[model samples]
Target chain A: MTAITVDRLHKTYLVPEREGGLRAAVGALVRRRRREVHAVTDVGFTIEPGEVVGFLGPNGAGKTTTLKMLSGLLHPTSGTATVLGHVPWERDRRYLGQMALIMGQRNQLQWDIPVLDSYKLNQAVFRIPDADFKARVEELSELLALEELLRKPVRNLSLGERMKCEIAGSLLHAPQVLFLDEPTIGLDVAMQRRIRSFVAEYNRRTGACVMLTSHYMADVEALCRRVIVIHHGRLLFDGALEELVHRFAGDKTINVELADEHPLDPAALGPLVDGHAVERSATGFSVRVPKAETPRVAARLLAGLPVSDLVIEEPPIESVIEQVFEATSAEVDGG
Target chain B: MADVATRPVSGRPDFSKVSFGALRRYYVGEFGASTANNLAYRGAVAIWVVTTVIQPMVSIVVWRTVAGPAGEVNGFTSAEFVTYFAITMLVDHLTFIWLMWEFEWRIRTGAMSPLLLRPIHPIHKDVCDNLSYKVIGLVGVLPAMVLLVIGFGGDVSGIGVVQVLTFLPALVLAMAVRFLLEWVLALSAFWLTKVSALNNLYFSLFLFLSGSFAPLAVLPEAVRTLAHASPFPWIVSFPVEVALGRRTGAEVWVGYLAQLGWILVALVLLRVVWRRAVRVYSAVGS
Candidate 1:
């Protein structure tokens, strides 16, 4: 079933146009003018129940605006959206109780109070039964390793610990749909992985639909099978991660280990050296070659150079996403 | 998402039965949490309480000293002045609405988005928060009330059981009026980014018009006439007047009707302003 349906969502903001200096400030006080900024324009997408989708975009590229609209935190200027077949802005209590929007930057947990107290408050707001509330709290606490943190005040917990509790509080009602905006924005790598796995496990257990937007590609790579790329308030790509890598990453790297201590001269490796970086040792070098030219470059290097060890690997996913953004921007500029 | 069938979304939460239970739980839980919150920030609370009571306490001392030696200025004795200030403290604390904080938050954090998304009106949460503070404030205010009565020699001979009984409903109406008006003011956050200056202007008007600075009787005849029409006097002055037994017979009933009227007007204003604010906020993409 389609859990979320959005069509031609457009959001425009009226931003005040103020110039610098004292004179302009005085003039603004007299007659203020505004410029209309199109944050999200003609964006459209749908998500099926139990599907995990990754939303990717650069900063100020309308990723958050689109997410906010989708989660019903925002209303579109001239489009329609429905979550679980109800208009989000209507803010029906039932809809609120069933769906959760967990933002990393803004915490929902009550500060200066124990995490359990916040959960209890959520229970009241969501009207969760006592038995279900207890069982779910226990389950979420165990999953997030929040056994000790539950008793401590939210203000006392570190960012990572607090985020875990935030996630737990958001889910105490077992919201069918979860909208996570950078759920691991500031966590260390291990904590990020832990959160990613926890989300995957939660999805597996409850079959909840999740739409996550993150700057971290590892989050997308690990948890999301299908990725939706949005840029400049438009959907640029919507497909598998593998296809994204294959389509965007047109190059591979070739690493070599020299038999003896000798630095390779760039003058000698003409036409074959797109780029090369030496390991700390003078005997080793890593070279970047276009995927189509990898075979030729490697063959030439092995035959003509005193190489001992060699390896070829794909570029990182972050590089692929960066390339996607670069390509999208170029296309936009060309148009 | 988990074959979790869509539940009924629009029906009310059984206001007659389950709501009572929910309200009970809400009050108990919210009170406990707020008490802990206030305790956790005891220093800040103490500072705030001191700042809050200073003006009222100072005015009482001034009026008491002015009405010296057998002490009765415009029919209010020294003891009456003490009771008036103490009662005003409790009344002001009860009716206080931090529309300033509410508006700033709705604007700054963009948390208003989620609030606007709920099926229920967001004012319910604000109402809960308002009451939660009072629930916690009772802990400090109760003892403080006793100390003021003993130290300043307040007289409650005129405070009958009927007056005490009527005070509850009167206070409820005052809260309703204040909440509706303040909620309308909070909606300004949606239209304007810098609303603090406007909010300051509002509080200044409220201070003068509400008899917070002085009893409505002390104001000039013209200002008193204006105060009668304005909602502020009805919110603070009428309640204090009734408690002090200053108003009686038909005027007391008139005060009750005035509160109801302001409530209705404020409710209408809230609806109109909220609709416009929602439209503006959604248009601006906050």
Candidate 2:
């Protein structure tokens, strides 16, 4: 069953215009100007129950806006979406009760109250029974290692600890769908990994559909098998993570370690590789070649050079994503 | 682990079918939490109570001086003036709603996003917070009232069980009318970024028309008529007069009917204004 289906969803904001100056400020008092900003344009996707999908984009690519629309926090300028069989924008209580939205930069907990108290408020809001609330809190606290932090006020906790508590509080009712927007943003590497693992484990245990957005490629790599890439408020790619890398990543890197500490000559590689793309160290040198030509180039390099160790790798996912965005922008510019 | 996690919690009811019993429990929980949160800022509560009490105290002193040695202005003696202002203070405390400032802050800081996401309407939480603050502030209000009555030699000989009993419904309706109307006004923040000037205008009109500055009878006939036409008198002056036994017989029943009329108007206005505010907030991206 499909947990979420968004069809041609769009959002446009009417942003007021203001130019800095006393004259402009005074003029604004009499007549104001507004410009329409298309935050999300014709974005559409679907997630099946138990599927974890990553939403990838650079800053202001409309990822969060799409998530907000799906989670019922926004009313789309056009199009429609349903979560767990109910229209999200209609904000049916059943839909809201079954889904949770967590924005990493925004907090839902009461700042002055203890984390446990905030959990109790959520329990009331979601109408979770005492026994079930206790059980879910226990399970989440154990998974998040939040036993001691639950009693402290939210302001007293570190950013990582507060985020863990936020995730825990959002799950008090064991929602069937989770919309996590940049859930690991601003967290340290270790904390990000912990949250990623916890999310994977939660999905494993509950079969919940998860849609996550993050700047950290590691987060997407660890959790999402499928990714949807958006740029300039448009979908550029949507498929398996491997497909994303394979389709957008045109080249591969080959690192060759020489038998001795002697330097390698970039001139010798000739037409086999781009001479400028070759970087030589004291012990080794690395070269980039078209993915289809890696094997031929490796053979020629081995036959021509004193190679002690050789390793081949697809370019890093970060560069591939960067290329995807660059290619999309280039297409837009050309169009 | 999968089985345990996937097992639907027993006794869980559909949102549409949620029982009133469960809703009551939820409201009770909210009230308790709100009260506890308010108690954490006891110093702030005391400051609010002091400000609330000082307004009426200053009004009473100024009016008493105006009465002079003969002690009568517009048929209100010094002792009667004391009684009127003291009751006004208590009534003001009961009916005050700070949502104008709160809504501005919430909109500016993006705090309204989480509220919009919840299954419940945001107004219920705000109502609970309002009541909780009043409940905690009563700790200071009651003592201040007692001290004023003693220090000013306020006369209560005219007060009886009937007046006290009549005051109860008036106070409740007044609170409802003030809260709903102010909440509607607060929705202006959704459109206007700066609401301090609007708020100041509202409070200034309320202060003069609600008889907070003096008894409505002492004001010019035209101003008194205007006050009665507006909802401000129903919120404060009408209730204070009822508590002081100054309004009785047909006047008392007419006051109740007027209070009910204004309350209905306020509720309808709130419903309409809140819908538009949410639409604007959603459109503009909160």
**Which candidate tops TM-score?**
2
DockQ of 2: 0.53
Every model's TM-score: 0.90, 0.96
**lDDT of candidate 1 over A1-335, digit per residue (tens):** 69989898898887789989999999999999999988888888889999999989888789888777766666678899888887876655666767888888886677888989988877776666786777787778778899999999999999999999989888877778889889999999989999999999888777789999999988998999998888888888889988888888988878888888666666776654644543334667787777998898899888888989988988998998898899989998999
Clashes by residue pair, model 1: A91-B117, A91-B118, A91-B119, A92-B118, A92-B119, A93-B119
Query: C-alpha displacement of A63 in model 2, angstroms?
Result: 1.1
Worst 10 residues of 1 chain B by lDDT: B1-10
State candidate 1's DockQ: 0.34
The 10-residue segment with the lowest total lDDT in model 2 chain A: A267-276
For model 2, the TM-score of its B chain against the native B chain is 0.94
Highest-lDDT candidate: 2
Listed per model, the TM-scores of chain A against the true chain A are 0.93, 0.96
